[model samples]
Each structure stands twice: as C-alpha cells, then as structure tokens.
Target: MKTSPRLESALKKLYTAFHSNKLNPECNKHCAVGNILDNTDIWKHLSDHHGSIKLNYIGTVHQRIGRKFNGYSPLELLEIEATFLKACGYQLPLHYKNTKPKNPTDKIILFKGLSDVIRILCEMDGIDNVMDYTKLFEVKNQKAFYDIV
Candidate 1:
C-alpha cells in the first residue's frame, strides 16, 4: 500500500515518540511489561504468519495487543486511540464491528477499544515496530510537577 507524505511524516513523529519511550509510562503497571514482551513474541508470530504485516497505524496495532490480554475492552481502547490519532492529524478509518471484514487480507485497519491519546501521539512520532522488550522501560519515567498556589 502506498503511504502519503503527510502520513509518513506523522509516522516518523510517532516513531520518535515510541523510540523515546514516552508512552510506556501510561500502560497499566501489571500489563505494561507483559504486553511489551508479549508483543515481541506476537510480532514474531505475525511476521511468520502474515509475512511482514505493515502497520499503517500503530495505535490500531496496540489495540490488538490490548485485546489479546482480556483486561480492557478492545473497542473502547480503539476509540480512545482513534481520538488521539485524529488530534495528531491522522484520519481514522471507519470501525464497524458487526460488518468487520472476514479475511485479514481484506482488512485495511482494525481497532478494538478506547484509544490511548498519548499512545497515538507516540505512534504519530514514528514508533510503529518494536523489537526489544526492555526498550519499553525508557517510557516509564514520569516527570514530576509542581502546582502553583
């Protein structure tokens, strides 16, 4: 599939965010590391199964990972991610559960639950594909804040 320059630029930004480990801080503690580890295995499986499945939208990709764990509802997460993606200037493809395509090859994109706005931002920075699990730790450090009186 051909990717637009605007999309490519947005993806580059997303990649930076991912590479910088910015969004990992927000993942639920119990699930965060596990998800990252599982994702690596899943990526391997996907690569073997589908032979290099291209990620047009990283937020959507994460939503799939969220679905595999059975904690959060995938659809809800996808919606939240979609909202965030839109904020980052990427138009989300329509989502219809009942009419979802039957074949993986037929599907352009698939998003499950509420989207993580921050995660979407990270993806827009060009962080779609991840190789190592430890890299997620870099995103765990949250900045401290002081309130004005």
Candidate 2:
C-alpha cells in the first residue's frame, strides 16, 4: 500500500527517537497497535463455530446473516490499524510508561503513544482519526505547529 507523506514523516520521527536512545526496545509490545493485534483473537471462518457462543442484547440487526461483515466496523476499527503501520513499513510511537524507572540514570524512557503516529498519517490521508492519551495537553511551542491537537 502507498503511504502518505505524514506516515513517512512519522516513521522518520520514530527512527530519530530510537536512534537517539530515547525509546525502549519493548515499546512496540505496549503500543496501541500492538495491543490490538497481539491481544485480540481474530480469524476468518467460513462458518460460525458451534462451540462458540455470545450473548448479544440485540439481535444481529446490523449483520445481514447474523454475522459481522468482513470490513471496518466502529468497534473493530483498531483491528485494521496495524495494517496502516505495516503499509508505512513502520511501528507505533514510544509512549511514556505508566510506572517510573527504578534507577534515575536509566536512559530507556518512553515518549508519547501510538495515536501520535496514527493521527499524523490519518490526517494526511484525509482520514479523520482524532485521539490524545496525554495526561495533560500543553502548548509549549505554539510557533512550531499549525495545530496543537
């Protein structure tokens, strides 16, 4: 798949941070993209498994045959997000870890989350994907960017 300029730019930034020794190697495992692809059990089946069962409060009104379509859905949007990274031949951003490092001198620190990469690429492709996981959104350098969010 052809990647947009924004995806390329995000990839460059990721490599820059990685090369600068600012990101941890395990960051990919915890990325939003990774969380979906690694954690979610997904597979294509010709027919439903008889052993599998689910309780839907409502019938499969959305599905033509009481089954999900093989395409993008609101809840499964993240399912295909991994493809975006693959298309760009890149991975997600290094997010700030939830816990602090034991040693103060540790150089392996995380940055922002995967949404940063997705947003830039999506915006460039005219796919409006907005998300921010920052604890506190701040504008320290207004002159540096055309938009803060």
Candidate 3:
C-alpha cells in the first residue's frame, strides 16, 4: 500500500532528522527517538485517542494481531517494531508478520521511518489473515546489546 502524501512528508522529515542526530550532552536516545516521533503526525491519531503516547503505543502494539513489540518506553517499542518490519523486506505502508524465524539472529536493522512505524502500530489491532500475515523477517550476523531489539 502507498502511504498518504502527508505521511510520506512526515517520513521524509523524520528521515532527515534521524540523519541529523542533534548533538546535546543532555539528550538521551529515547528522547531523540521520541522527539522525532513526536514531531510527526504518524502516531498522532493513536496518541490523541489514548490521551498519551505511552498508552496509545502500548495499546496498539499490545492489542495487534501481528508482530507485537513493547518496551519500557514508546520510542523504544517504536524502534523495535520498525526494525523488525524492515528486516523482513517490507516497504513502507505494506506489512508482513507472524512468520517463523529461521535461525533467528540477535540483530535487527531499522531503515524505515516513523510513518512506516505508525502503520505497523496501527495494524496490530486489525483483523489479520492468518495465512498471509504470518511472516517474521530475520537479520544477519549482528548482536544486540539492548533489550528491546
């Protein structure tokens, strides 16, 4: 599926922001990621509906029928979801999940933007075709030091 122009624009902006990596001694990774997500309209629907990013993020991802990712923070969960989807070769807006991992690796590469992540998050609660939706993308040789991915 093609992303809406507004979503696309948000993704491009987020992509640019990600590359910029605002340098500040006080800034943390979660804040950096959250700030980018906060700046976009991707998660606005859920956030507003749930009254907070933390709640909407948790409810959407936790209630979803596909790959469910959660963390101590919304941004961390968003990163995990995006990284998992990108690893499976899913382009932005399209989706695949629930596939069995073949020799699952510890590494997950995240290349998509916040738009991609928001779509994935929104899909979790919808009715999914069990046959078509079961696909989990695996990664190559890389180790994750963090608990999220």
Q: Which candidate number maximizes TM-score?
A: 3
- Which parts of model 1 have CA positions greater than 4 angstroms off? 1-70, 94-149
Clashes of each: 31, 0, 6
Compose the digit string of candidate 3's lDDT tens values, residues 22-91: 3111122222233344443343333332112343654466445343222123444444334433443434
- Alpha-carbon lDDT of model 1: 0.33
Model 2: CA > 4 A from native: 23-112, 127-149
TM per candidate: 0.24, 0.23, 0.26
| Model 1: lowest-lDDT 10 consecutive positions | 105-114
Question: What overall lDDT, based on C-alpha atoms, would model 2 receive against the true structure?
Answer: 0.36
lDDT of each: 0.33, 0.36, 0.36
Candidate 2 lDDT, 24-142, residue by residue in tens: 32333323322333323342122132111222323223333544323323123233333333322333321243333343223332333344445644654665554443524444665
Residue 149 of model 3 has an lDDT of 35
| Error at 33, model 1, angstroms | 13
Name the regions of candidate 3 deviating beyond 4 angstroms: 23-149
Compare candidates 1 and 2 on lDDT and give the better one. 2
RMSD of each: 17.0, 14.8, 16.0
TM-score of 1: 0.24
